[model samples]
Target: MKQKIVIKVNIHCQKCRSKAMEIAAVADGVISVAIEGKEQDQVVVIGDGVDSACLVKRLRKKVGYAYLVTVEEVKPKEEKKEEKKEEKKGEKPTCQPQCHGYPYFVHYETVDEPNPSICSIM
Candidate 1:
């Protein structure tokens, strides 16, 4: 079955982005890789039978710090729109426990070299 895997990687430059894409491209089942979100921190991968844990490990080793955000089965556009409509009608969107059952991970890193209080989230 096809799945959409969204991962958060610590990308700081064009080189980092290129490395991230390269690592993801050579992954076992990655059909495509793209950067998403306003901050361009989310890497979206679409493929069949993609292993989330292995992909995260590869990214961490080759790209930088990486974390699994979510792994979800791909859905048709009409089904996705229906789910969105249900969300708008007060239904909570169901979350699949793909990140080892964790809701989310908070990655803390220093924003500036001299200041500890200046922090960023990934």
Candidate 2:
């Protein structure tokens, strides 16, 4: 059974990211480890029968605070791509939105809390 596990960790620096990757790579049943996210805080591990709890624990002990975010069983990439291609073959390409002498803007009140409003001027 193949599994994809995502873990969120409080990674602060390059060294921390390196250590986190190393720790995740050595864990039992981990086939591959990839660091994701802009902050390099999300660890994506894909393998067969990977132990999520144990991997999280090891990361916490070796590379600071870490927690499991998600675990999903996914089909092989080739199968997924083939399915996507078949689906796309029947779909028409959509055109990009065009702005015709109009101002478009989004306003957010707070950084921590996202309250977005779109404003348009013609």
- Each prediction's RMSD over C-alphas, in Å, is 18.7, 18.4
Q: How far in Å is the alpha carbon of 70 misplaced in model 2?
A: 0.2
lDDT of each: 0.81, 0.80
Per residue, candidate 2 scores C-alpha lDDT tens digits across 63-105 of 8888899999968755554454334466445432222346879
CA shift of 36, model 1, Å: 0.5
The residue pairs that clash in candidate 2, if any, are none
TM-scores, all models, native as reference? 0.61, 0.61
